[model samples]
Target chain A: MNTNLYDYAYELEKAMRSSDEFKHLQEMYKSVTNDSEASQMFDEFRNVQMQLQQKQMQGYDITEDEVMRAQEIANRAQENEKVTMLMEAEQRMSMTITELNKIIMKPLDDLYGSMA
Target chain B: MNTNLYDYAYELEKAMRSSDEFKHLQEMYKSVTNDSEASQMFDEFRNVQMQLQQKQMQGYDITEDEVMRAQEIANRAQENEKVTMLMEAEQRMSMTITELNKIIMKPLDDLYGSMA
Candidate 1:
């Protein structure tokens, strides 16, 4: 596994969170369960990501620049935190997955053929 | 007037670029001007912002974390840099501006009245 696997995982997670299909499922779950189970799952995922990031940066001393940058990030997150937009974008992109896969087919096959 | 004016300006610029109204304008300009004047303007704006940020950070030493963070940002920008989505989001939000303004009217009036 590549060191970038974590990055890929993160992107996949983000993509799933942003997807229309996922949103529809979430809405369905909410209606059926009469509870925000999907939303709670998202919060759990975010908490895990935060914990992972905190653990990753454990030994590093927080600098003034980091403090300023963190504050800026927090401010932006608080102000324009549109999780739905992200999900919607993912949904739009999900609809194109087949097209994307078709576009990559030749290159992926070639790469696999070469390795084989 | 405010230190945050730049942020607001940046958001406005982003909003314009993402808007269907603006995208149509851009396509029209490209078709007529036979040049991507709108896109060029956006590039110039981005360059100016970069220069301003560089000037702001002049006295400070760039830390390892900054370097890493910069690389991460660059990679993400390269991969999923959908300027269209940002513009679309802006367009979507722009359409709701009147509604947003209506929502904020009372709070704004209260603040202004207090200041007066």
Candidate 2:
């Protein structure tokens, strides 16, 4: 109920916006958006990720063919300048968020500890 | 790739640990952990949530019986003092995290825009 938490959270959000990770991510994303070829490549990459994630959630194992197909797209994505930059920027930002999540989850972790 | 982001993130993490919301959530969680009945009730409430999530992920619509059972457990959770406080604190903290996530995803949101 205290507004102090919201204040601190908002402050952090603002800080994230000003951070270098967000800046580079924004730049790379814009580069990809302006290029149709790059945009399509990025989209395909994301689709593969989503497909893999869906299969994982359904308790289904991905086939070797699917893995090879995904790898092919990934290799292609990495070869494209805009797509490569965008992916790297995305990973950088994602890593920051992942680290932040661990910090946020500390209390629940404490509760689960041994039981988890 | 920038160290400054890490510095800001760690600063925010430290602030979160010192925030009233985290402190209150910690207290409530500890209270529930120390109480056998309260912990059981909290666990049951979480189980219902996980069950619903699993069903939804599997593309299944929950039956009315399942809905009623979930509601029953939820009602009991709200009635339990320890569970109530812990849940409230969890929601309060979760709201902050959700808001933060929006800020973190701004670049991706911009990239997807109408396509999303």
Q: Output the number of the TM-score-best candidate.
A: 2
TM-score of each: 0.19, 0.69
Our model 1 lands, by Cα RMSD against the true structure, at: 19.4
Q: Candidate 1 residues B5-109, lDDT tens each?
A: 223333333443354444553443333223344444434444544754674445344566756655554444334324333334445444544332333233324
Model 1 chain B worst lDDT run, 10 consecutive residues: B1-10
What interface RMSD does each of the candidate structures achieve? 20.6, 4.5
Question: How do the residues A1-116 of candidate 1 rate in per-residue lDDT, one tens digit apiece?
Answer: 12232233333334444444445545543342333444444344445447546744453445666556555544443343244343454455445443323332333243224423
The DockQ values of the predictions, listed in order, are: 0.02, 0.28
Kindly report which residue pairs in candidate 2 clash with one another: none
